[model samples]
Target: MEEVIVTVLSEVRCHLGEGPAYDVASDTAWWFDILERRLFEARLGKGEAQVHPLPVMASALAYVDDARQLIVAEDGLHVRRVADGHLALHVPIEADNAASRSNDARVHPSGTLWTSTMGRKAQTGAGAIYALHGGVLSRLFGNITIPNAICFSPDGGTGYFSDTHENVLHSVPLDPATGLPVGAPSALYRHHGEGGLDGAVTDAEGLIWCARWGAGCVDAYTPAGERVRTVRVPAKQTSCPVFVGADFGRMLVTSAYEDMDEAARAADPQHGRTFLLDLSARGRPEPRIKLGAI
Candidate 1:
């Protein structure tokens, strides 16, 4: 078990730090504090991070281009004006339901978007996964709780996602042309009770790297469910992993200090901070959302 050293990149603490995405064109990265309703961005290697306020609980985002970002907020999917930090409603998805909010999300290689929504109270079966293609939004699954691990395989033929509370990872066959699932999803891996699965990302080698919430580490698994590598960070509540930095040779992990008491925070000063790890494997840029005239 080879270990990688984790370095704290930012000291900002988030109640729930998730949704990490790198913008290659801008040489920056973006993440969100869902509970705080804040968005953060910073240059790859230089400068201070900038914080932007969101009107709603902004869970995840995908790059629309260098100048705009597509976001899944509490209300619905929106197009964010990067220059002015303005968000415009693009598609309405359960906007009237205050109990349900956007959760995990990612874009597909075919310019489509896949995002999930969950109940605010963590109610059972109060969530579902949705896919947006060619200006149409469709639900993929229902009766889900704590949706996470939304990623795709390198070839774009497989889609991976999981419900944190279920402690299982699933893989489904996808339509390459439309980036939608063509068949039923099956279990690829099960975490048992070690820790719940959270956000995940696929590397250039087609491996899925997942953050185990209470395990303080990120594990990589092959499509066949074999554990290949494990990289430990200092934070106990690791939230998500995103490949960033020069040549995509680095992994940026987000953490959370939410619900931690004074003694807990004192023991782990880096609890909610962001961390960077130097990795040998490279990563491809996340797919950009192709908003055709929307």
Candidate 2:
């Protein structure tokens, strides 16, 4: 198989952009700047990106009941109504010490919204993961130091969650009916470094395409947790990646320089920008189902 092509779609300036999701219906890509606390949407070939200021640190996002809006993970959960720009606060996230906040999130096939939190200063095992069910948020797992990428299998029977702090990946058995993991999470794989392995996207074949933060590459892995391929990037700290556009063929990635040194930042101006990758795989993703008040 030929290697995937990674190209700079937008450059190294997003004020710490993290979460990225593609909207096939609108023919645009969406992502958030966590530190900047803003949500953004940009159509391919479009001149400018539309930015919406959000309350608190917005981590990751996905489609909600409405196609025009999304369920956003910030310091809390928020629903951004696309038509009026009205943001409805849904959950109040607890701060460990006014220094901790949420991180990566994923919307499952069964419509459950899952996300995790991280310590403000990259502290170890202080973060946790949670799920938003029927608008009510509940803690599902913990001991996470740097929770990042999250996604479910095509069958919704499994979920992939990564902790960047320890560079450990976990696979939890998912119960689709209640939308929770069934047993103690098991290790999928562990990297040697303390970082890399951030945001992720699942291909149609159930393989994972992960943003190898600090590795300057997007890594693809088989279901058995084996490395398959890598999309080398110019930026070192790749924040996240997701399949975009109709048929989920277009892959989009986000990178950050927030944790880089002065010399590194000076050397790379595109560190915080986003990139587009052309994958051999083609197909749009299934949108999260909207659950009514339970």
- Against the hidden reference, what TM-scores do the models get? 0.97, 0.91
lDDT by residue for model 1 over 1-294, one digit each (tens)? 357876777789989999989987777988999999999887866866888988888888998877789988888998998899888999988877789989999888898899999999878999999999998998998989989999998788999999998988999999987889999999999887667899999999999999999878899999998888988888889999999976888998999988899998898878998888888778889988987777
Model 2 regions more than 4 Å off = 1-3, 45-48, 71-73, 95-97, 193-195, 289-291
Name the best candidate (by TM-score).
Answer: 1
Clashes of each: 0, 8
lDDT, model 1, position 3: 75
List the pairs of residues colliding in candidate 1. none
Ten residues in sequence with the least summed lDDT for candidate 1: 1-10
Tell me the deviation in Å of residue 260 in model 1: 1.8
| lDDT of predicted model 2 | 0.76
